[model samples]
Target: MSRPRPRARLTVLAAALLVGCTGSQPLPSTSTPAPVAADAVQDTNPQPRERLRDGGLLRFPLAALPTQWNPRHPDADADARRVLDPLTPEHLALDAAGRATPNPDFVTDVAVSHEGHTVVTLTLNPEAVWGDAAPLTAEDWVATWRASTGQVEGVAPVGPLGWDRVTDVRAGASAYEVVVTYAGVDPDWAQPLVPGPLRASTVASADAFAWASHRDAHYAAPFLVAHVDQAQGLVTLERNPLWWGDRPKLDTIMFRTVQAEAVAAAFQHNELDVWETGTSVDRLQQSRAAADTTLRTAPGTHGRSLHVSRAGLLADAALRRAVLMAIDRAEVGASDLADLHEPPRTWSSNLLLPTQPGYVDQARATGLANDPVRAAEALDAAGWVEGPGSRSKDGQRLLLTFRTPIGDDLAQGEFEVLAGQLAAVGVRLRAVTGEADLTPVSVPVDAFPLARLPEDVASVPAAAELVARVASEVDPVRRADQASQLARLAWQEVVEIPLYQEPQFVAVRNGLANLGAPGYATTDWEDVGWTS
Candidate 1:
């Protein structure tokens, strides 16, 4: 089963091409996360929508075509969530500082009350309507709660930490008014319910969010789903003819799915106007060679970690802990940051990013070290006898694969280092490369940091309680401290091991206004156009 995500946070996305492929999917089903910017976010080329050009085609490249159309579903990757953003209601918008503000287009007013628990009332915008021409109403929110909380059968609620807290959903006065009650004080109440007011009519069944070949959802945003060509691997979005808000600036936005290796070539050949050069020096260099391309740089909102697969040979907790013990995290961190302009820096806690306050080096605090000698001893104690170049236990060789994007030179380099380090400890590593290869042992997380820990970690004693505390804690100081404790538990428990924070690196065609390195700011589709 795919891992459940915490509902209070944004959907976790990979910062690399893994976002599109199977490698990003967790060993079970990958769910990653990013930091919520408590400080100034990496620059996103803020521009006045009025000053941008009126019309142009913004050709965007998605690492892989999005198959899952539902933003709230666990199968939805970064591409799916991003592609769906332009077609969804913006009840709450995250600002540069990661503060949630009510967008007047879909939510006319938001009033919160403290009636013992907590009640949040939302006044729906009468002007907002779905692609099927249904008005945005309270019924939609009620259905969303039912679907999101898994009250409906067969349709799995995407990691429902946020929705699980919702106790009641009913219309206040009219269909336009929505009243919500939560179990406790949720600091980020809007995150879980903001993404959808699922078209209430069709979401009652199991197949509502996903279809086998292609999927499409109802829309209320500035853009309309013009087409989803599964055979062609293209999703085209055009201005909504029924839009009642400000007119969109672009004629259309096309998301073309291409292989990881082909991305640079596509951008250079002018087939794509925007390219996400995910921490790969080779791809970044190649993209810069494109005509009029501008390289946008900012401290990344995402962090990379070493995720251990739960079902493989590494399933033995002792062996899993030994695998982490064998490698030098600092050496791996150096290679990941190599050739980049940002100074070499690695973080130990995924809960609070390095940019946030109350951050701590959980690995050191938990006593995880790069002592291969200790690792070898641990393996020996676990009954694996060390041989010339490998270890064996009951006829099984200590061998594993480190998967990466085929053309990712940076990933390959890191793989080489990881392989060599493990070899010294009598373990052999294989380099596996493919578009959707199944292990992103080293993937960057881009969502709510607190929600990104492997869902299985909750199985550990007090782990579930810690996660709940972190998610519900409203005070910044208390939350950070609670997150610090959880981070320590994640490391000590040998779940997903953190390495460091990555810088947000985006390479886009020059004059592409409002679209580069957005960091914490959500994309404003209507204002994103070329500056002719």
Candidate 2:
């Protein structure tokens, strides 16, 4: 499951702790001149677009590159694929479309053991080779486990949930098997192994695998540690000359950081081949309609939410419920200029199109309905009596602070709308435009006084686990139940109201081919091909 980055927490805290201490600066406009849609010479079967030719340069904008290049590491960022591609990479590597499927660029086949907790076998492409020409092998898997689990020294913790279950990881002739034995029978054991990668041979030895249970510095991916060029803000991955499958189309894949708006503008100017940030939906739609370029929109598993602070009267469930009812999600979505997002019913559901699997619709149906009448009544029942055109309880006025990212225009607009809605219910809603600080009152789970988050599903599981763990009673079943329950509640409470699914948009030159969208596990480099 996708997890939120630690930076997001810091961002929230920074907003709260430093509010009014600093002045808000408007983000520079990176809007681009609208491009004429690239001409589409009718291809009858639109399912498969022609592959791009080799040697073609694909330049795309990135917001930030990861300090760690390895995908298996806990701290790996979404952009890590630019440097290291995982074995059995998921289709549409960066985007979550469905269950991860094999990418032709990496592993050949993945086999799961029948017992469900024992073995997961991955057969690497016989031709697979690292950028440095070392054959990809079983040793890599062993190393990966050691590093991610903190079995080695001098490595950072892979955060809270380190890899501590696997009993053994061994490599066979052409296949590598990771035999995992959890503390107990975990039905979710299949998860950790599906996207397994070979550990770097340079760092830990086979014997180190036995020490995987120890939390040490072996948590960092060696490939990333060795190959990343931090000064240049670039990660260059040279083709594995010995790669078993067809050699990767690009000689070297370079991931570079650029401003989000600049990336959009670059796509319009044809300076970049792909741009992932979803900034201007109207411009993209208009451009595609005119045939300047192919515009493909897919629902993403990301979202945005308005955090409610539990300070003062908001600590009351009735007040929290009232706040939820006062805001109109549909209206906020309507006012959004970029149709890249939609009103999210629950934080558990994917923020983008057609809700996620196992998502329940009760949050939208009953919990957070835009009903001022019900909201006011709930407030009254909770001792918040409306008096002289205001709400109060025991002589204390009902007041709340809504915190959002300071410089984020999109969130600012959305929160402003929410503030106006809450005002009609005799509630004093103050819009605090700054960093989110939750340290003062030990931040309430249901109502965080501060909220700032990226729109990715990777973080969803963590949020869910936090919520479930807080309420869990049984120690043995605490984590599992917490995870599942959090996943369920993400949809149930609409904890983080998602606005839309954002897509990475790339603008390729006319002659480029073999460009398809990358899935959640794969990178853009996988789908790209350069035509003659």
Candidate 3:
């Protein structure tokens, strides 16, 4: 018989956060290029090789390099985190199926014991050592845990989620075995172990958040930061001589900064070997123009959606449900990428990506079909009398203000169409551009109603808590169920309307091998090589 999954009962409302991006070579073009078919050619996943090459240089692109390479530091930006990922040894890896797989180079096994409290044991490979020839022991583990959990004062960790619950860290049978006891159940024992020993020394410093050095202070993987030129926005990673695993297939990997707007140009100019952010239609067109480029496409993890506010006349639960029913989610997503090619990017679920396992169609399950008739009926039953342009109740008009990220034309267009859909059902949506602020106080504006109260921030507590729970759950089956539950709640409660998830596209030179879709995971430095 299987043990029953431990359930944590808690309630908290918050917003979901997502982060990340993705690459190729081509001849320079001087004249205006004709538009190419988006899907002119199909590409396949690169197959593994029976035998790999020993040395080559792979040129990659980064939007920018973080001032510091520390992943655990609070000040480390997204760019820094991207460049720092592969250089830091990974203790655990999430496979394509999202199951945690132990990295054989670092950890031999990971086991959790729950006896009143949760205890996690990490059995490291005795042969594992840092790039500096330092044997990774219990000290590194202890320091990393302490710094992340705030057990040490003056150190600001990135976040105190799983680490905060850790009660003790001690050496097990040997220095290579780490025993960590938590004050409460921590189902996510693998996540915090990724950076492993790479963060220990920097995290021990009092000013860890702002800590910067002329060079990498430590390294754990097969690559070491050999050079960083901030002025030119370049970072070069050289093969670590002290690597204990198989020697890397590449001699060096270079990350150069290229603005998002300049990516297509960079690829067409043959300045970058891999265009890591080639998702948009224009980007695909540019890659298609490059004869030697191979595009790798996958279902992306990040999503584009709208967060509705509960201020003004939208405080009623029935109205919230009505707005969800009235708006055509498919149409909204369609309008988002209308200018692009056919077959919308990919519809999204509030919980898991479509590519993930155990995903259920909660939008359909919760009866959120884009039917305006049912929506009007829901509002009518809720005592919102129909009026010109919008419905009203108690002398208050059914007016909603929406805010999307600034400078996003696609999102703006999506809201514009949604506003019309809602207007047809007697709900007026004011699509605006700015940050979403929920504070009641109003800031002065240069328009009518110079000062109006801010929209009330709205969130589904059950949905948010379920997401948190899903992250911590260890069992794959149970985690999937929890994820489905979260999605169901979000759709049912109309927490937020998930529009679509962008299909990830990575353009790379045809010669490059063994690199998966960008952002899927760190590149296998030991396996990535050139065919030539």
Q: Against the hidden reference, what TM-scores do the models get?
A: 0.70, 0.63, 0.78
Top candidate, metric lDDT:
1
> Number of the top candidate by TM-score?
3
Query: Could you give the C-alpha RMSD of every candidate to the true structure, in order shown?
Result: 10.1, 14.5, 12.7
User: Taking the tens digit of each residue's C-alpha lDDT, what string does model 2 give over 249-277?
Assistant: 55555567777556556567665555443
Model 1 residue 74 CA deviation (Å) reads 7.2
By lDDT rank, best first, the candidates go 1, 3, 2
Clashing pairs in 3: 22-276, 22-277, 23-274, 23-275, 23-276, 23-507, 24-274, 24-275
Model 3 agreement with the true structure over 1-532: per-residue lDDT tens digits: 1112111110000000000000001112332122211121223344454455667777877877777766666777877776776676566554332324456677665555645556767778777676656788887888877777766788867742456667788899998889988675454444455546544665666865455753444667778888888799998888877777767778888889988888788887778778755345576778878767877765454556666555545556678888878877677656655534554444445555454455566767777767899999999998889988789888988878776556766656766787788898898876556544111111121110101111221145545566555545544456557766766766676655666655557788877887746333434566677777
lDDT of 1 by residue, 1-532 (tens): 1112222222222111111111212222243222323544655567787678888898877877777777667788888876777876456655543445556667655665444555777777788787767787888889888887778887775643467778999998999999888887665566565455777765688877664333233667788778888789898989887777778889798999888778888889989887778776687789778998888876567666766666678777788778888877778777877767655457676465665545677767877767788889989999999877699999889888777776776667778888899899898988777422124444443344454455656566677888878766644456677777877776776776666667777888878887777656667677788778
lDDT of each: 0.69, 0.43, 0.61
Choose 1 or 3, whichever is better by TM-score: 3
Error of 3 at 420 (Å): 2.8
